[model samples]
Target: MTDATRVSPFLGLPGAVEGEGPNAGAPAHYGALVAEQRPLERGGAVVDLGNLGVIRLRGADRLTWLDSLTSGLVRSLAPGESGETLLLDVQGRIEHAAAVLDDGESTWLVTEGTRADEFASWLDRMRFLLDVRVERADEIVAAVGVFGDRELGAAAPNGVPLVWHDEWASTRVGGVSYATTDAHPGRDWDLHVHLLERPALEALAERVRVGDVSAAGIDALEALRIAAWRPRLARDVDSRAIPHELDWTRSAVHLEKGCYRGQETVAKVHNLGRPPRRLVHLDLDGSLGALPAAGAVLHVAGDPDRAVVGQITSIGVHHENGPIALALVKRRLDPEAVLAADLDGEGITAAQTAIVSPEAGHAADVPRLPRLGRRSG
Candidate 1:
């Protein structure tokens, strides 16, 4: 394995397995690993999530202020709804990716893990005259991601207090005061967000019979995200990666909302043309036990020795498909481009490839409706 894909010595056990591959145990490959270890009969076990950020939006201006600050149309969200948003700079680069959850009284912003305190404080400072408040929720709540079994999926319902009873594992996820049965038996699962219950969460984290789960580290999680064709922040994008470039204009940006930073650039580029690079998935066509390193050039087959496309950002070996990878290729490059290269003396080859098809970039040049509850003279 190259330095980029090298298994870290600091990580141990289950973390090692998840961090070792590109799928990070989310794709079919990781699913197989879970089967071998736990050998599930009715349900399957997924990885536990920790790399996420949580923030609370309070005060009277919570909804209006957040609507103005983020890319999504937050002003229209109802009590039980959740919307994804992006924080973009004036130059159109994304600073953060957030999932906003409305709970009638307040709003929650869950972002990819970063300096939670710092980000919350920075957002607070931006509120100046607006009657809005921001606070870090990392200390107040601990999160666990669970994906499998649609039957148990509703454990974390949108509007009500989270509660479940699945024999071995059951729990509650929210600000409510309640206890739950252990419904999780290493099967179809749900992400648990225990509020103001740090000790209980930690204790539960220990008792859960999840083997090889701890092995899936942040690196592995990233691999699974890429394999799933999910967009990641820094790896796939740079300071110049606008929402449109990431095909995130629809999911993250609010085209019909009032002006915000980067709105002009977003409007102009979107209306006039498409971004230069696009995020794509690749099936490496070689026996490389490890996948390609980030930023490794994808030399198209016919044009050997010349790079018609860019290199990889994420990679992993699949259970059914073998070696797989994700990269930001030049949009004009052929979807049928024969990707070939060598890593650590292993000849890397890829056949299958697909682009993430998000909604077309927005045209913000169109006039938007007035924002509600603006400070009126």
Candidate 2:
């Protein structure tokens, strides 16, 4: 049973409205969703990500062990360096995602709150003869998200500020992008996560209350994230999701890394086949005054049969972009084809912007041999 009484201090702000689902235990908005979103985009406001989980790993084998288990190449991370990594099932389906930061002596993994316990337990079970110790630090640490490189008075337990800078703006070494667009939306994304001690979080909350620092909620943050085409493990992924479909290879995956749980599938898919589906950004028609909920079925516009071609994964009302969403559609769907999302009995038109290109995958460009049977004219 989940504890209903657990809540973040930021929820005490005036006009705060609690969030739901993955954002539970934190404020959804402070009465003005759009207004709150503007300040956040400009790096003037902070969003309380207290719902994120923190895990600490300390040992001489921590980095090497983690590199062997996750998708990112973290074995070479220097002190205070940040990286994004994904834990995949044996079949290459994403299981967990984390913002990784090292403080020389300890490696901190900040992941979705809902996955913390399960992630920690799995790590504990895998620690057979390693020098590593895994500790769930949710009770003592909290997370705050901000844009740009603004200083937030973060806690520095090991002489380095506990901040995990997101590298989604471009592909890193050993990484490849499935998004064919030269000007990817994520090029403008500059998100950062700060891990804070209990005392630091309390102090920051007081600053927010006194107007010394601005505060936004998950609603505001979600809007910016959707607009940037950033994929969150908790919201954008389904049971069959793999890194290739979401173009997560742009940041969260290292194709040239050493063997890991799902490396075989990752390599095979990239070298020989295309992802079954591709992610796209949807500019939803908002004249109906209602946004399509996540998981809403999407169909080709003007289709007489209304055959479903995709499903919405995340939606947000951006301050500038109005209604926008991310959805996964069939990779073979015509890129110029129009799409519509079904909300109850109404259909809302959506303009598609490719995130993962339909032509993605087949990275090795393997040649196809001529058909052996010869032609029948």
Candidate 3:
């Protein structure tokens, strides 16, 4: 076994290690921890998503203005209703991706923690002449995520939105005001519990009794996200990559919506056809050795030694599929092309994972050229 494969005492799971904490040097279960805690195998799992963004938009125009600016149809979100949405620039590149909930009095946007300030600033600029007030609620709110099949409680004013999504059995507990959204497995729900006190935060974490998926880690979550083909801000896309390249058109882009900042480019691309690149899944061929760093080149199928076809965005060992990765490949490459990557001097062959194919049923399509630039050669 490779030295990197050495198991640590902190996480009984194999190949675990401390990832980004005060205990950075400490050993912890990297992927196994996440898997054990995923809402699937076990009944529930808790993630301290305090690092994710929580933005509060209050004022009368909150609904109409937010719906006008973002990619989701948020004007329709009744109190308690929740949905995932994306904030895009004029070029159609994603600025931030969020799961939002409305509480009649206010709207809450929960996203990656790093995007809190940036999203707030962007939304603030778009609020010209509108009655909406945009503010980052990070200091006032604690974000936690829980996933399971169990039924939850009413979490909104008049119980309107919560009652609307009654089909899902998840709820928030505590005196703190907040918003709750129903979500799919591996698709975590954001609990923007109002942080009135420190003890309340600690108690909420304990009450939920979030069991760390002893096997799942950020790595595991990345693998699952890649398998599901979810795109993240900064990593999968930037000002350079359009939303379609990352397959975010489904939940992020509203084709029927009238107009917004990047609407022109988005509509042009949709009508003309062909996004710059296409997101693909990679089933990495290897043991539990190591993974390549982000942006590592993937060799093209027809010419592996010379031409590069794509780049890896995320990598990990999946609980069900073992070593795997997600990548953004040049569109010229065949959807079924055979590819391989260099992982620590070892040649790791990777088969294209099925993502956009129609057989998959929900696979997102590559937006046409007018919507995004031509694919990189």
Per-model CA lDDT versus the true structure: 0.53, 0.89, 0.57
Candidate 2: pairs in clash: none
Task: For residue 293, give model 2's deviation from the true position in Å.
Answer: 0.5
Which is better, 1 or 3, measured by TM-score?
3
lDDT of 3: 0.57
> Which window of 10 residues has the lowest lDDT sum in candidate 1?
172-181
TM-score against truth, every candidate: 0.69, 0.96, 0.73
User: How well does candidate 3 match the true structure, expressed as C-alpha RMSD?
Assistant: 9.9
Q: Write the per-residue lDDT of candidate 1 for residues 1-377, one digit (tens) a residue.
A: 31232222222233233332322222222324422323222124333333445688878788878777767777766775656677788877788776677767667776655445556877988999888878876555544433333222221323543221111122112111011112211223222332223454444344332442332234433444444455666466666677655546534665657887777877676765556666667877654456667777777765645654766776655434556677766767767767776677555777735453322333424575678976656
The Cα RMSD of model 1 versus the native structure comes to: 11.4
* lDDT value, residue 243 of candidate 2: 97
The most accurate candidate by lDDT is 2
Off by over 4 Å in 3: 1-18, 21-31, 34-42, 149-198, 207-217, 301-305, 357-377
Candidate 2 lDDT over 256-301, as tens digits, reads 9899999999988998888899999999999999988998989999
Model 3: per-residue lDDT, tens digit, 1-377?
11232212233334555554312222324445545435533434433433455688899998888878877777877776666667778887777777777888888887666556778898898888989899876555544333333332323333443321211123222101011112333244222222222344445434433443322334434455555556677467656776666656655566777577787777666555566667777888766467677678888544735488788877666677777677877766777678877766666778885443312212225454554765676
**Candidate 2: misplaced stretches above 4 Å?**
1-6, 362-365, 369-377
